[model samples]
Target: MPTKSNNTGGRGGARAGAGRKKSAVKEKSENGNPGGRPLEVLDIPEMEGVEMPKPHDFLSAEQRDGSELQAADIYRETWEWLKRIGCSQKVSSQLLERYAMASARWIQCEEMTSKLGFLSKHPTTQKPIPSPFINIGINYMNQAVRLWNEIFQIVKENCNTEYSDEAPQNDVMERLLRARKGN
Candidate 1:
């Protein structure tokens, strides 16, 4: 039998002071960087006479039920938000369109799930199963979130000043609910 040694070299695993460095802005605010160089300032110029673009006609149709029309409205709302935040210049039309489509699909899935209920009968097996809309809704929601994060990252990288929401009264869910109810 070989004797077991207790000594182990510090080759792997996390060490002290490892991983990502804290934000320079946060560090400067907390402890004050006395000798460090000053942080760079970004000056984003305002565009004069900038007009909001109209979404493509495919986004809405009278024949196609509620979701199509709602998607166009959602796209307009999102555009208004970007413009209000002074970050509209950073977002592209394609990216915003993708986000709106994902969100509208998610809402459509949820509405279907509500009507269909959780359980369903398999066509071939004749056995009860979970509704397909549940999984579809989750996927659409995740895609929307991922797109939103990408948009947010663009805004975060470009904006120099701290972004704050002035109107907390206008909640997203409430607006959606009101739209759904036709209130």
Candidate 2:
């Protein structure tokens, strides 16, 4: 007598609709807050009649030229932004100084790379090698990103106001902050 064979036709895999059912989870918005529980909005107190400190107080005299000067400008602009958003009290002057310097250095390195090109000559072998400015720029950019992230962490957790950019379209720092927030 012939035995009855399975109808799978030698197929060993799972059939259609055979896996576990997916849970009906609600999608999160940009803030990553689900609608079930109430989100705790932090109220950062605004500073009243405070004077913005000069960059010379934080940066040494020797570090106040070219890109460093630009860094100083960046620091001032960021301070004003923080003040406007009511989170200036949360971040320290030292942190802003560091962030500015790193950003400036990154830009300086990128400029150098663009001007000098990516290839360089070795000291002894005289072979074409990747420009040192490329790695230096990347390192500076990483530092700037870390510092910016730290600043934004405070702002995101303790500030209820939306991050608004009223600066011109050419504002590099503002653009960078917005990009970081999107991430």
Candidate 3:
């Protein structure tokens, strides 16, 4: 008697129909979702005829002392923000004073730099000449910039807001709370 042979090779047995079948009809939901839950539409009520309060007027009267003029708008806005952040009157005044001083120094540095550029020229060659005052002005400008940055940082820290272009989750208060929670 001849025995029956079993040859499971050449695209036979497990290899045949092992992949997914291509469906002729595309499956879809009644809400047009393709294999997910239906979209939700919320019915929000409209708030018509609600009068909003105007922002506080922070610009104060300008003061002029002979040749020097005070920037009332800058001082006013700074004072308003500092007050909103719960800063004391004395601290706010001190910060504003420092800011004004730095701003004045910055203006003076700009003037000095411009004057130096005009004065720094050779008599015959007409070439630009170097002077120590340029460097001094640059140093003063740097100091003023540093003070301005310090003031901004102080305000940002006290106000619990992020001034940089980072992600919202990286806020100072969020980080502090996360650290306190041992997250």
Candidate 2 TM-score, C-alpha based? 0.64
Q: Model 3, residue 65: what's the lDDT?
A: 29
> Residue 170, candidate 3: how far off, in angstroms?
24
Which parts of model 2 have CA positions greater than 4 angstroms off?
Answer: 1-45, 57-68, 166-170, 173-183
**Which scores higher on lDDT, 1 or 3?**
1
Which ranking of candidates, highest lDDT first?
A: 2, 1, 3
Clashes of each: 0, 0, 0
lDDT of the structure predicted as candidate 1? 0.68
Q: How far is candidate 1 from the true structure (C-alpha RMSD, Å)?
A: 7.1
Candidate 1 per-residue C-alpha lDDT over 1-183 given as tens digits, one digit per residue, 9 for 90 to 100: 765454444355677646754353434544676547775434667786677778777666553554444567777888777788777766888888888777777777776676678888899998999998899989988988878777766666565456566421133355446545655
Which tens-of-lDDT digit does each residue in 108-183 have in candidate 3? 4445455445357767898777755567656755764565555654444333323344321123224334433545
- Better candidate by TM-score, 2 or 3: 2
**Residue 44 error, candidate 1, Å:** 5.8
What are the TM-scores, per candidate, against the unseen true structure? 0.68, 0.64, 0.37
Q: What lDDT is obtained when candidate 3 is compared to the true structure?
A: 0.43
